[model samples]
Every structure is written in structure tokens, then in C-alpha cells.
Target: MKQINSIEDNLEILEPFISGLNKYLEKSRSLSLFKKLPIRDDKENINDRLLEGSYLFSPCGVELRESECNSLALELIDLLKLHLTDRADEINTISDHLLNEKINPHSIILSTIKNEGNEIRKKIRQLNLPEDLFTFFLIYLARPFREQAASYLLEKIEKLIWLYGYCPVCGHWPVLAHINEESGERTLWCVCCNTKWKFKRTQCAFCLNENHESLEIISPVNEESYRIHACKKCKRYLKEIKSNNDAMNFQFDKMYLGTVPLDMIAEKQGYIQESILTVRYDNPAGNELLMYRQKAIKEKISIN
Candidate 1:
């Protein structure tokens, strides 16, 4: 495995992409592009749902207003074209489609949030856009709104009693893990909503496999702070950063971006990166969690 002294070294290697991404992120966060999403403040009700292993936000339950989605999509595409010079022409084409209303931003936003990869691919094919590039742009366009909604919901709830492997906010699998140097506690980070929650150190985040013999942690030589936690039973791996100081200074997003080499190494070793749409229900516990989520979604729809 390739070794690096610090995350900054990795960032230097990915400077061109990182530079463009950083600008996009900064500009996106500055604008009040999204409408204020509804927040459920019924603590007792929330507690009951949490106890039942239900996540706060269901895939289809999130209300991304059409106007806001359209506005944000145009803004993001324009910014992508400006900062990401290599893809200017492609992004400009996407921008024109959004401006002309040939592509419905609202539908695309919903499909992306729901992890409907096939639907996204179909749209890309019809439009003749670059598949991977378009998908990447769409994911970023939807991120800010999801983060906004999750922030609102997070403020109202006092305690999160969720014990499930997937995110408590978005139902997406974790993209990274932070291990406290002193406490040795593992906290999982949701890729979609940026929600954080404590999870079992020995358990597999993908499949919840708890056998010590089946779980392994591997780190690159001379890189003590970084590690990859792999599950032999499920053939899945999660990137981890073990922080020496208080983990407050660690930026999960940057760390995820900086650890591209770890991802390559894990993939080369036959470990699979679990998709956002995948929900593990093979175990009885996982089944119950799924049931609770279904019930929550139904209730949310009925109320709406």
C-alpha cells in the first residue's frame, strides 16, 4: 500500500480536482438556495420511531421543492463549468437543458436522493451525456439540500437512539469512519446527509458482522493514523481515520477525498464498496430495522 505522511500530502496529489471542488462547495454553501424544509419536533413521536430502529428521514419522504431544485441545479452546473474547465462544454450543455426545462431538475433530484442509479443512467443515455461525469455532478447538486434538511431535523431531536448500520437521517451506507484515538469508539459518517452516529467497533457497517475472526483492520506502512476496516465475511471495507487529538478538527469530507489510495488498495484486495441503495436485511435484526423504516415511510406519506 502507498504511504503518506499526512492528509495534506494526498490533497496535494489531487490538487486540480480538489481546487475545483473546493470552489464549488464554498459557493454552494454561501447561497440560501434551498427552501426551509419542514422539521418534525414531536420528541415523543421521534423517540418512539428511533426506538423502533426507524431513521428520521426516508428516501421518498424528503420534500425537495421543484423551484428550489431547478434553481440550485442551474447554479451548480454554471459553477461546475467555470471552475472545472476541463468539462466546461459538457456542463454548459447540462446547464442549457436545465434553463430550457428540457430536463426536470426536480425528478433528477428525487432519483439521485433515492439512489436510483438506473433511472439516472437512463436519463444520461437519452441526453447523450457522459455517464460517470453527469452522475457525479448530479450527486453534488443534490448534496446541499440534503445536508440542509438533515441539519434542520438534527436540531429538533435531542438524542438519537438509532442502533442500525445505515444512516439515521438518509438510510445511506456510511462512506467513512472516524476512530477516536483515546476512546477507540467508531463513528460512521453518512455520505448523503453528512449525519454522524456511533457504531460498534467490531461490527461490519455493511452487513453487521460481529465475528472478530471475520473482521480485519489494515493500514498502509508508516501511516499510523489511517486504516481500512475490512470484513472478510461480507467482502466490504470502510475507510477509517484514527485521530490523535480531539476529532473536532478532522473534516470527514476532506478525509474521504484524501484517502483515494486506500479505496484503490481495498478494491484491489477483493473488497467491495457497498452501494448507497443496498440495505442488508438478511439478519433478523436487520429485518426488524427494515420493517420499522417501512412503517415510518408509510406514516410520513399518509401525513403528507
Candidate 2:
């Protein structure tokens, strides 16, 4: 585990939520839920996808047992319930559904869960459950599981690494991009499974457009060090932070939330805050990635 500088003392804006997340993450690895996750495997798995010199599982390819997923989700819900006093009943209901395999955490975060005009959305509103809050809960619960699964495959394949626009592990797009202060190289950070990969500095992660004219860089006047890399081709944006390699302990999850203001700014400029590459590529994982990516491209092309 990497050590992070304490930001708890400075937290007052979203005190309960932000501080709780920081505190929870500090000890998340030690929790029994996280410990139960499978570790580095001695034997290579048959289902691991070998892509661009890395071994990764598809979004649905994580080999976690249903029992394991339920246990992890239950524990995570219990932890979240501590901070979410107002939503205890809703949390309990969520717990029941998760335990019964009636709901999947990954699907929710990946935006693949379609409960529109369903009882679930009605329940969500009735219980005052915010979509972002629910998604956060899901991501936190699923992170350790995905991380452990990826590690198992990476251990067997010594050269396992990815340079693609999408996550090699989960096939999701990066939530943040950062530059290596020393090498000046670029890397994409995946919030889904906490994976990082080197990527082409000039290429757009979304539409894979390499035209410099189509890429616009926006920087906040207050925070000159941070940048919003927006692609004119796809109208999609990714936040970039300047950090040294030694800062591997950077709290990317926390940083991502803290930079919501930047996301808003990007969105106001006609660029999207979310990933444009949500689709699963053509693989055994089916068209999950491909469909999403194609839709994003089609929408942007039509708009322009």
C-alpha cells in the first residue's frame, strides 16, 4: 500500500462524505471484505484477455464468486451506512438486493444497469438516493475485487501492461490523465480498478483522434498546473494533473471528486465530463464496449 499525505485536516466542504471516504480508503485494504479478495495466482487463468502486452479481464470477466461479491457489497454498504445516516433504510434495501444477486455493483457504475421506468428508479427517488452517491458506493465495493483479479493475471504475465485508450483490465475509459514530472510522459488512470497505463501524449483517448487541431487544452486561471484536455472531434474531456512519479500514493479517487468543478467547466464549454469510450471492444466480452464507443462517436459527429 502507498502512503498518502493527510488531507483530512483540510476537509470541511464535504466533511462527512469526503472525510469518510478518505478515512475509509486508508483502512480499506485491511478490511476483511478486501482481504477475502483473491490475490496473485500461481497458475495462469484461462479467461484472461491478452491485449497490447497486458492481461486483462473484460468488464464482466472478473472471476469473483457471487458469494464473494455479495459479502464485499454487504460489508461496504455497512461501512457506508455509518456515514449515510439519512439513507439507512435505503442502504438496507440495497444490501438485501445485493446479497441476493438481484443487483450488480459493476453494472451500475458502468452505466449498463437499465432500470428506467422500473421499480428500482422509483425506489431510488422515494428513498432520496442520489445516483452519484449510489455509484460511489458501488465503485468502492467493486474496486478491491477488480484490483485483486487484475493482480492475479499480472503476476503470471511479467510484461503485462497497456497503452490503449481504454482500461486493459475492465475495458472502461480512464477517469483521469496525469503527466510524469520527470519523464514528461503521459499516463491514464482508471478509477474502476485503480489501474494506470502509459498512453500516447498527443492522441485523444476518446475518439483516438491524433490531430492536434482537434485537441483543445483548457486550464483554470486559478489552478495553472491542472488542465482539461478536450477533444474537438468527440467533444469529450479528460482532466490532467501534474504530479511526479514519486506521488504514486496520490488519492486519485478523492482528487477526481474534488475536481468536479473542473468537470462542470469543461461541460459548459460543450465538452462532456464522462468518458467517450464506454464500449467494450470486439472481443469475447461482446459489443458492450464497441457499442458505447460507437454511439459516443456518432453523437459527436452529428453534433459537429
Candidate 3:
């Protein structure tokens, strides 16, 4: 891994690819599927649920209408093939199999949300498609929906107390962390749904190890604002950005893209990325809330 001494140097190196990907993301966000989708509001006993380690919304509880799912999936697939010219051939092959086999796009979207990569890989193998490429594509295709849902639910829970390592909105692990320059407070940013939540600075985001001996920060030379919070116990690392100003306006997505070298460096050091799903099912209250929200979706009941 090449040593990235400055943010500008890193961004300059990845600018071309990042620019194209940003355009694709912008066009994808403008799809009609985001407009027509409904987001359920669930605020009943919100803090209690958080205390019980129950995420605000389970993937099963979030309703993705079949028509919208199919339309959005097809549109995203087309957009990827159009904007991402490098992957055009691969996208075409996967899209052909996905459509011709009459596979319900909603099922794949749900599976991706639930982090069922094995099922997706199985399907990809059956279709004779590239496993890693199609799996990433499916996740990218499902991103907008998760992000939209997160946007709707963020305000409802952002101020509430949530101490968990995973996302409160989507049950996904943090992809990035933001540290306040003045206060030294840490906020974990979710990879799947783009949600942000407050977390303890001394604790490891992956294993929640707070012994201080098992946790360490790896900072690149000449980079004051960037570092990696790594856990020796789990061997998982979270890339972090220290916010100097306008923390609310920080483009985490762009920062994440610009910091690819950080991932490479961390991986080279034998640290792995955090798991997609957190271990929340062990709590009965989490299970109860999951079951309740799922039932509400089935009954068409708007949770108040």
C-alpha cells in the first residue's frame, strides 16, 4: 500500500473515478422510486427500544413495494451500464440473467438489506455471473432505498440515546467515524443507510472493547484529520475523519471514496473491515421490536 501523506494527494489520485461515480450516484438519486416510496414512522418507546438494543427499523419492516422495487432495480441497472462504462459488459450479463430468469428484484433487494450475501452469491453462481461484481452491484442498487428510509427516520431518532455499535436505522455497521475537533466526540456513520449516531470515543466500534490496551488509533504521517480506529480483539478497523468545521455539511460519501488508500493500508496491516450486520438478535427486546414492526407492515398498520 502506498503511503498517503495528504488528503489532497489521495483525492487527486482518485479524482477521475470518483468524479464519474459521483455523477452516477447523483443520477441514481433522482429516480422516481425514491419519490413514490413510503417511509413508516415508528416512535413508540423509541428510547426503550434503543436501550434494549433494538434498531429503529428492521429490513423486514421497511416495505419496498414490488412495482417500485422492480422499476428502481431496472433503472439502476441501466444507469450503471450507461454511466459505468468499464463495467458495461458485466452489468449487461447480470441484468440479462436477472430479468430473463424472472427473479423478483424485491427479493434480491431485501436479501441485500438483510446482508444475505451467501444467497446472492448462490444466485449469481447459478446465473454464471461474476460473484463479487454482482454482489457489489446488488448492494449499490439497494442503497438508494436504504438511504431514503434512513433520511426519513434520522430526525426521529438522531437526538435519542443510542449507544449501540450498529446503525439504529438499518442494523448495519459503521463505515466511517467523525470526531469533533473541539469536543472530541465520536459519531459513527453507517455504510448501508448513511445514518450517523453518537458513540463512545474510548470504545472500539467493532467489538466495543474499552480496555484501551486492545484499541489503538493509526494515523498517517502529515494527516491530522484522518486516522483509523482499529480493534485488536476483532481485528476490525473504522476509518475516521476529524471535523474542523461545518460537521453537518461534511460529505461523508465523498470522504469515504477519497480514503480508499486508508482501507488498503489498514488491510495490509492485517485489520479487516467490520461485518455488515451487528449481533443484535441475542436481545429479546430487539427480537420483539423486529417481530412487532414486521407484523405492523403485514397488517398495514401505521406505527405511531
Among these predicted structures, which one has the highest lDDT? 1
Ranking by TM-score: 1, 3, 2
lDDT of each: 0.72, 0.61, 0.69
Off by over 4 Å in 1: 1-8, 15-41, 59-67, 82-102, 277-304
- Give the per-residue lDDT digits (tens) of candidate 1, residues 1-304: 5553455587676676666666666665665644436456477887887765556664445566676677677767766776568778888778777878777888888777666666777888888887656866776777777676677677767766677677877777788999998999888987677788888888887666688999998887778678899999769899998887555556777778788778877888899876554343322433355545455545644665
Rank order (by lDDT, best first): 1, 3, 2
Off by over 4 Å in 3: 1-10, 13-44, 82-88, 98-104, 277-304
Runs of candidate 2 exceeding 4 Å displacement: 1-19, 22-55, 59-71, 78-129, 245-247, 275-278, 283-304
- Candidate 3: residue pairs that collide: none
Judge candidate 3 at residue 33 and give its lDDT: 49
